[model samples]
Target: MENLPKSIQVIFDKNPKLSELITNPRLISNSPFIFALSQKLNYSAKGNEDEYFYRIVFKEGSSRELMTINSGELRGLPTTTCIEKGKISDVAGLERVELDNESNLMPVLLGISLYSSIQNSLSYISNLCVDIRNHQILEGQARFERISETIVDIFNSIPDLALDKSLRDAYLSRIVKNNDDCYELYVSQREQLRHSLKGNNPDYNSKYYYENELYLFKDKLLTHPVFSVFERLVAGRICEIILSGNYSKSNIQRHKDFISKAESDINDIMASRISDLDRRISYYKRDIEMDRNLTRDGIEYHNTQIEKIELGISSIKKQIFNLLGVKLSSFDLLSQLMSKDEIDVFLIGGNLIVNDMQLTSDEML
Candidate 1:
């Protein structure tokens, strides 16, 4: 529990298997048993304002003898406790022995407990978003328009989480897949696509739905690209004209013409570009479909590998904890090993399952 992050501890405390012990049911705020205990014993703080926890010092008259305080009461306690006894595996040769009291002990123990979880929570959320984004994107084959803001926001959060590089790559692909899906969805809505593409044209372009429509829609799609420096500059220029409060018809007309030309140029270029875009989209769809299939397969494969690797890590952690009777981080373990290239390192921890390496391969076979 000391080694686990709060978020992870919360996750586990909610677990049915571990709940009875870690999150044992107790009388909460209104219970008389709580009031009795509060009046009777000293509580070492757990350091969270909303979350309360107090340690019952095992002394002559400590109330823990009568009733053990559960996590419900323990959640709101701060880290200002004066008790001290834990070895600092977090720092090298870090050992402090004193008459254990509230003022010193809480920071050392609670700090490592708290900070570890925060970094882990960020990773957990980032991973979950990546998985959902990937799943949505992979399944999204034909649709290409009306992409939801939520999808975009989650995709954007990948980088903000400071996630490992591999997950970042996974998220980038997911974003592209979603964009492609939206594109497919847009083209499927023929009438709506047609109207949007018509763009205030008094006379509608009554081209063949499947034949010229693909090219035409492609052109229109390119016309409304979300951003470009030139278009931005044009917008800025128009804004400058407006802020000057010159509502002169001539000035307005002049700026309007410039705006019209920019729009026209974008539209014209898109029309020509759409022809190419149609081919590109078709080609991209097939290529992306293949890539999507491969990526999903790759993700599954890597996830399996990651699980295997993490299992080894867990084994390593358990070994260290068992040997030292304290949790040492990966870096700490590596540090203890120093520059040794290959360590036929002994696995020491909670339950060290020793393998009979003495058994020959032939004997095992």
Candidate 2:
């Protein structure tokens, strides 16, 4: 659970099967559980606050005990306690007395637990989005457009949970500063492709050359450090927003154009699919009538083709259902953007005296 992102943990805690799939890179899709978890975060965050608590376990013989306090009415209550002994694994050139006096271990472990959860959450969301766009069944730019729109919408719905502007900008600024060369190359390749496309007799070789270069550019974009940094930033922002309830209009609007483009592209795909289905339906019906007395094999082949057409229609319907809801501006469509409702934030007081910070629902947003 410590290794998994909070978003993934949310799903894992509810459905154990999903936990198995977490480390299995081959099976991560926008599965029903993922979608459901996403919805819960989006909608639940809007109403109630999420409760936060920290737990720590210490090793003792073959088992572990919850750390606890020793005084007052809550004397028996679990508390942050000290480690009394070290394992055989800690015997490397270390004095026995030194092992028990490792006072810095607690904060080091706490910091790891905190940042690891955050970084993992960002990786989970970004990887999921990329995987969805790269599904084998999709073969064009429409998938990118659709997923881009989905990302924008999801980010927009979450309350602005970004930290101070300087911190947020620091992550974002890295994108431009670190990737100037790649950005220039990408722009040059795009311009080259545009020029090639506008030519009267652009050779197949030239077209392929430009296309391949553009594909490489995209690969570079995905692998770039800045891309991962931005994803972590977005994930952290969303987590904070859901927990805090603060809304950042600027953050929400960052990818508005991308969303608009995706919506347009998806709409175009819907229209094209509908048109193709109508044409194929008419053609197949006429062919069946004209060959009314054909051999059994010929008739079977026609029937098979018709069945495939029917399947295509069914697939488009499902895609439409997933990508765009029954009506525009409906909450159901917001499911596409999801990935929460709320709880609370806390720092359990003990040896660690960080008091629980009180915040209202609005302040959280």
RMSD of each: 27.6, 17.1
Kindly list the per-residue Cα lDDT of model 1 for residues 165-193, writing each as its tens digit: 23334544554554444434433332333
Candidate 2: stretches off by over 4 Å? 1-123, 126-164, 172-260, 266-278, 290-298, 316-342, 349-365
The TM-scores, one per candidate, come to 0.19, 0.32
Top-TM-score structure, candidate number? 2
What number of clashing residue pairs does each candidate have, in the order they appear?
36, 27
Q: For model 1, what is the C-alpha lDDT against the true structure?
A: 0.33
lDDT of each: 0.33, 0.36
Model 1: weakest 10-residue lDDT segment is: 345-354
Query: For candidate 1, what is the TM-score?
Result: 0.19
